[model samples]
Target: MSDTRATTQTVRYRERLWVPWWWTLPAAVLAALIALEVNQAVSALPNWVSFVVLFGVAGAVLSWFSKVELRVVARPGGGTELWIGGAHLPTSAIARTAEVPRTAKTAALGRQLDPAAYVVHRAWVGPMVLVVLDDPDDPTPYWLISTRHPDRVLAALQD
Candidate 1:
């Protein structure tokens, strides 16, 4: 999706990362089971009411999970921006961009990461892009962003 904010600026790259189907399917199933258990525990409610509640809860959970998305947008005039859930980061303050291997990503997310760095991680996404912040005003040292296409993100950042 393109955003027409100004004439000079153009959105170069856009990526939206959502929870995969594998995760959503299992989450839905678990929600349904939990709803069933709750209905059994509260038997005073009518059967139809219980059924409706179960479906409603399960649907709501599924919708919430499905709607969770990590959006990355690169604008030429402005900078690269990452939107994960509700968090947003502008890459203009970024000093460097590095493509991290899967193993490196795993390690970085664990005990190897800087305490002050910001991380936008998704376990399912293997490759990641590390953006180091240069802005003196910002306290965050870097950002670890999970991306399927690291090369594209890197190129956009470099541009």
Candidate 2:
């Protein structure tokens, strides 16, 4: 006999939109080059100072470029939430959701896009999900979110 019960997992889906690993190579190299220039221009400063600047600039650049994350969570008590970057919305707020194929992305984001819509987009990630809001109190018409796996995102939200 099958034991029927609600899923115990709290996180339905999670993805980090990180910059490519090769990205760090160029960023670090540039930072190092800049630091070398600074060192040459200021010969009085300690050699270690240039290293510090290199690490600081590269760390900050990498961190800043790779922070967007999407997560779907099932609340401990009840309810579900979709988190895009830093913002979040309850699944109950979503009236409907649709996939925006790569071909139609330009149209969706162009003339048809609403000024008040909540959008978290990444250039590297193709395909997206449109979440139409039903909440009367909310002024935003909908949310356009970029996802590497739109199907997984849709499935997570549906569940």
Candidate 3:
């Protein structure tokens, strides 16, 4: 006997918010400077000990800056979900959506911003998408998600 099952699932948009390549050089330079200071201050420890600090600092910067990821996934069961970091929301729950340009970002994140809104903002990512939610049970009125390609993200959700 043979059994066959077929399923269709697709990832519409995916963006990993990693620290830019240029940032690595600056982080390494800063780490080296700190290690030099540590070496000067501590004469009893071996010179190699300062190298440990240098590596640690560089690793920490890279780790922290590369964490958040944005994705839109289409389910085989039928529906779209938006994922940002650890949180996920169905696109059906979104009432309206808008792309906030770099110039308007400050205003979007400023005084008018709601405290209960879900925000996955990154300073390094210039543009973001504002998702206004219609779910009554969820107190979150909106979600501000940082993305490198705001238009693509919006298109995925719409489809």
Candidate 4:
């Protein structure tokens, strides 16, 4: 089953947070290094081939991370919905919403979180919104979503 909801309406709030330069830089460098190593293994390959491979790998990695978007849309009829990448959750199903502190965020991502909880986390982002699921049918206990504006996300979830 797909995680996204099919909807055709204007979004109430949209937050797109790209992977920080720090994260991208390392990924690019690593990709380039790997490409170089591959080129050395295959001496017949031209230098330009390695460069193209490096940029292609790096660009694909960067593009995937950079395209991550968090959206909170108010459905036309009545409910609020949260979207992280391709996953979507209706606010009605959220039992609770809170703005998690940095320490709590770390703990949640580390030892504290339940194995059943869903996490949409980005290492570069600090503040996050924690949404506890109320739907009994769903096995997920909660969702940990990284966001630059945690308060805004919390408000949207509550609305």
> What do the candidate models score in CA lDDT, each in turn?
0.72, 0.86, 0.88, 0.82
TM-score, per-candidate, Cα-based: 0.74, 0.85, 0.89, 0.82
Judging by TM-score, tell me the better candidate of 1 and 2: 2
Please write out the lDDT profile of model 1 over residues 85-110, one tens digit for every residue.
67767877777889998978768888
Candidate 4 per-residue lDDT, tens place, 1-159, comes to 122534555577788878776766787788788888988899998877887878787878777877889988877678878989889999889888888877788777888889998898887788888899999999999999899998888877776
Candidate 1: where are CA atoms >4 Å away? 1-9, 62-91
Candidates, ranked, lDDT: 3, 2, 4, 1
Task: Tell me the spans in candidate 4 whose CA falls farther than 4 Å from its real position.
Answer: 1-7
Q: What would the per-residue lDDT of candidate 2 be over residues 1-159, giving only the tens digit for each residue?
A: 012322553879999887777877888788788888988899999978987878887988778877988989897678899987768899999999999988888898999999999988777778899999999999999999988889999999998
| lDDT winner, 1 or 4 | 4
Candidate 1's TM-score reads 0.74
Which has the greatest lDDT? Answer: 3
Winning candidate number (TM-score): 3
For model 2, the superposed segments whose C-alpha errors exceed 4 Å read 1-9
Q: Compose the digit string of candidate 3's lDDT tens values, residues 54-91.
A: 88869897988888888888887899989887788998
Per-residue lDDT of 7 in model 3: 30
Q: Say which prediction, candidate 2 or candidate 3, comes out ahead on TM-score.
A: 3
Worst 10 residues of 3 by lDDT: 1-10
A best-first ranking of the candidates according to their TM-score comes to 3, 2, 4, 1
Check candidate 4 and list the clashing pairs.
none
